[model samples]
Target: MKTLKQLLADKPKTLAVAAPDDSVFQALCVMAEYNVGALLVLQDGKLVGIFSERDYARKQIRNQRSSKETPVRDLMSARVAYVGIDATLEECMSLMTEKRFRHLPVLDDQGQVLGILSIGDLVKETISAQQFLIGELERYITS
Candidate 1:
């Protein structure tokens, strides 16, 4: 089982934030620019919530909350499920699968934000692991 630490070491790029009260449009723009599906919502360097495209449709547009007037803090999913950097990649996969979320922020023990992981990240890792396993199996058979 690969650990979150290993995953982060493998892919050092992370999407992070320190404030959500700034502008919802900014968040959407950043996500679009990065081609990411979610953004970590933070306040005072602490993880507060998560703003995802899923939340956009369900909490805002469907609810008629004006994106231009609303803030990310107002639309974010405050009850975000988080994981530690030392956590297993499998754990992240399980949590996201059960909750149906595409992104998760990795935090330190003090609850400080470290990095964010997405479903795409998990899928990439899973595929890599599978490929390695397959190669090992092939080598074993050849031997």
Candidate 2:
């Protein structure tokens, strides 16, 4: 029943971003610097799309497109899956699984981007919750 807000609070507050018109190479460099697999494509401070390592491999590398010439808008995934702060972890996980996405941008009610969530983040939270539940059950049974 944990919410996306709770999960985000546990993570380091950093969101790597790139301009939509930025070169794919520039975006990739930012990703490398941040040690993140994806970068949010922002245009005029709005969330426009997402560029990930997968996109680079599929759109640029596979097509042999020059990274410096390719724009993030052309290579980024435009159909982004967004998760609200109020959304449950289960909801986020289900959406990600159904969509086959490794990253989800966290949004607020006002459609403002807050943070990004990765499949790894969801998995870690699920495991922690399961452990807490198991511990509670064991204590209850022993008592």
Candidate 3:
């Protein structure tokens, strides 16, 4: 399986972030614009939390909180579980599955934010890898 570093390198380098004090609505707009499901809550260029559509549905809407008035920090998942650049795809998948989370922020050796990965990203990579391996096996058999 590919490491987190490899996966990130293959992906686009853009990262969508939101300020802690930004309104939830503002964060939602950024998420929509980026076509992403979550945004890292950054404060002083550091990862503070993560806000996702799940948070909006379970925390904001369920609690009847106004997204326009509430800050992203209020709804973001504060205790984030992140992985290092060298972490394997299987490790990430296990952690995410155990935690029941859809997203994980990737960090470098110096704890700098590299990027974020979603469950969808992992699944797509796994499927791609399987397809490639299958094609290789078929070619070997034909040869």
Candidate 4:
């Protein structure tokens, strides 16, 4: 099984983050700039929450809240479900499926944010692994 650490190592080492007190508009701008669907909400380098497009659409826009006026902390998901670097892709997929959320912040032993994972990332990895295994099996069968 591939661990999150391996997946993260293969990805670009960039973390899109926002301060909890930052405006929702600011968080959205950062997300757009990074070309990501979500941003980790950090306070003093610690994971405090997460802000995503879903949060913006559900918590802010639906409620007629102004993104420019509202702080990210106000709409961000505070009860963040995170995973350690050693967590397997299957574990992440299970958790995400059960929770009905897409993003999960990866943490280190000290609870420092290492990176974030999305459902798309896990699915792609899983598909690649399966393809490789199938290729190997075919080669073995033909040998």
Best by TM-score: 4
Which lDDT tens digits does candidate 3 get at residues 32-129?
A: 99999999999988999999999998898665668899999889999999998878899999999999999999988887899999999999999999
Off by over 4 Å in 2: 62-64
> Using Cα atoms with residue i matched to residue i, what is each candidate's TM-score against the true structure?
0.89, 0.93, 0.93, 0.95
lDDT of 2 by residue, 32-76 (tens): 999999999988778989999999888885655788888898889
Give lDDT tens digits, candidate 1, residues 41-68: 8787788888888888777765555676
Question: Global lDDT of each model?
Answer: 0.81, 0.88, 0.91, 0.91
Query: Model 1 off-target regions past 4 Å?
Result: 12-14, 62-65
Better of 2 and 4 by TM-score: 4
- Model 4 scores a TM of 0.95
Worst 10 residues of 4 by lDDT: 58-67
Q: To one decimal, what is the Cα RMSD in angstroms of model 4 from the true structure?
A: 1.2
Model 1 worst lDDT run, 10 consecutive residues: 10-19
